[model samples]
Target: MENVAILVDGAFFIKRALHIFGKLTPDELASKLCSYSEKHLARDRKGERNKLYRIFFYDCPPLQNKVFHPYHQQQIDMAKSERSIWRLQFHDELRKKRKMALRLGRIDDINVTWRINYDKIKKLCSGRLKWHDLKEEDFSMDVKQKGVDMRIGIDITSLALKKQVTQIVLISGDSDFVPAAKFARREGIDFILDPMWAPIKEDLYEHIDGLRSTFPKPCNKKKLESSY
Candidate 1:
């Protein structure tokens, strides 16, 4: 019997689920996720039950400040509420640090004789860097600085090297995982990519052995409400 390990990107999954199914209560969402997992397991090898391995959910806690968009805030709120309900061990990445870096300048003071550099630095300190002040190329510079991809990759590789499980199921749509998937495949482990309720990427199909989407069905409102 092959053991199947499930690695869930909590942030990605929650956002996808909420986007697909309206706003669901924490318990309702957790139940739906479990159901989705069961379906994925049953779909493999003619309903033969695979050994249930540990389910690892990776995500950073919401910024202590609710600075994210409204939808994102809802997702993060649901995740916090669901942690205890689902017995999910939350693994926090440095999301706040990344956010800070994106908003703040990266380089230390470079001595410049130009008045423009001094003026720019003063404006930055005064919180005057508006959207118009930035150039098109600077859009990329606003990306979150934390490397969630690197963290996920390291864990996947470490588990593969340790021979912790026979198969790995990763729940994320981020293409950044392509290399990690390749590495897992090289180790002769089955790499399944489950994008929870997100549109499937055709290019990713070739890399993964199995694909599953966890879209919530039209659930009864009363039942969902009580589960919370």
Candidate 2:
């Protein structure tokens, strides 16, 4: 049986989950992630499953500091913020899951700043909205994630060199993993990319053994619910 190692880009997964799975609690989100990873283990026609070596999840911890919000005209304590709490709880849930490795990076808080929302900036550029008309929702904290891609690359190289798994499934939409994917394929590992229905770059097609997405489409929420 093929031994599979699933690597997840946590931020990408969370953003896509909001669009595909809708709103779910942190615990529910973590459980759904595990369930999603299990789908990769399914083999052809006969009801067979592959051996799961492990799930490596890469993400940066939420920023934990007080930053002034220009739109809100107040200081926001990110450490006690809703997103921070949710992320911490989600990480904890992942830790309790079996055969899961939570690999965390760090936030570049020193260079952190509030960025104007894309839509708001577009409106301003098109003369549809004025600068003074921007509301609190028009701005969001820009937290730069550092070390995540590096950590992912390191883990993939380690797994391939150590012969820990015969297959590697990366669930991310970014093209940053091309080098790692190429290396894994050269090592005789079946590298697969699961963008979860998101479109990937055309150049990415040549570096992987196969492309497969093992989740319900956004339009098929009912099927996803039934699976659980």
* TM-score winner: 2
Residues forming the 10-long window of minimal summed lDDT in candidate 1: 96-105
Steric clash pairs (candidate 1): none
What is the per-residue lDDT of model 1 for residues 51-85, given as tens digits with 9 covering 90 to 100?
Answer: 65666556543322212322222323333444334
What TM-score do all the candidates reach, one by one? Answer: 0.57, 0.92
lDDT of 2 by residue, 100-143 (tens): 99999999988878788787889999999998999866666777
Model 1: number of clashes? 0
Task: Please list the residue runs of candidate 1 whose C-alpha ends up more than 4 Å from where it truly belongs after superposition.
Answer: 43-48, 66-147, 217-228
Cα-based lDDT for every prediction: 0.57, 0.88
